[model samples]
Target: MPHPCALDPEQVVEHEYVGLLDPELRERIELWEEELLDAEDASAGPGNYDSYEEYEAAMGGGGPEGDELTYQHDLSIAPGWKVGGFASRHLTDPAPVVCSCGAGMRPLLTVHGREWDSGTLNWVPLEDLDVLRLPGANVPAGVYLGRGLMCVFVCPADPAHPHRLSFQ
Candidate 1:
């Protein structure tokens, strides 16, 4: 995939045939699918791994805390376990999960969109953001934020831009 053509925001084309995906992103996504497919066995059973080495490999080795990914820019939205998907916010951004400390946990997609504007949780790369088939959708697993928050879908003028929601 090619980087979004700097000259025109609407350059290239739509998904499938579009060349607007960022080069790094296209590459990383390609790699992630590979990793996901190669997900290895843990050391013990269920959630436990064979050893520290196996554990790290299974979870892709994280920081000193062992978090799979870094948590930043926490926001406030649906907290606790989310039962149903948020009605219309999935397209913009998932409701942010705020920690008791004041900072809101970043949206899961923001974390997925590593190059996101952490402050705003807006994905710098456009392709990975919410995409729709024009009208409505139904995500059975409960379309939600990573930490498990409700989500709603929104449609922007340019589908590439981050969708906005009334909630945080």
Candidate 2:
């Protein structure tokens, strides 16, 4: 996908956060997390990928860890997960993002620098820090969301349409 026109903070529009759920929401999310952790396998799971040699062993030889260490980011949206938040990138349009199809855009993804910023357990596993910090890892080919929320937006009219990425 192509990047949006390079825009200044003043040039682009903005939006406010409006999805603060009730206190019960946090309890539900915690319950869900516990269930998920219990249901998943010990080794064959997120943030726990075997090496090439281990993969080869799992295929035909004895399965075990290998020299290379591979990891996957934990998808569990921890307690801090919020909705309808501002962009978090150091440099990017704020909000009120618009689509090329002449329609208002909505958020598709909110890429935070950390699963838990502070004052709580770091839900983001240390093993996945590299993936989170790497520029363009979650954004477009050239665009960078910096160390904040890289909120990716999509056209509400059509899901297949191109997306718009912005940082706050």
Top TM-score prediction, candidate number: 2
Model 1 vs truth, CA RMSD: 18.4
TM-scores for every candidate against the unseen true structure:
0.18, 0.33
Off by over 4 Å in 2: 1-94, 119-145
Note the Cα lDDT for every prediction shown. Answer: 0.33, 0.45
Residue-level lDDT tens digits of model 1 in 1-168: 222322212222112211234677667655765564445333224766667787666554533323322112122222222223222243344344344443533322211112222233222235424532222112222234443333333332333434432332
- The residue ranges of model 1 lying beyond 4 angstroms of the native Cα positions read 1-54, 63-165
What TM-score should be assigned to candidate 2? 0.33
Per-residue CA lDDT of model 2 for 105-130, tens digit only, reads 87666655434433222343454456
TM-score of 1: 0.18
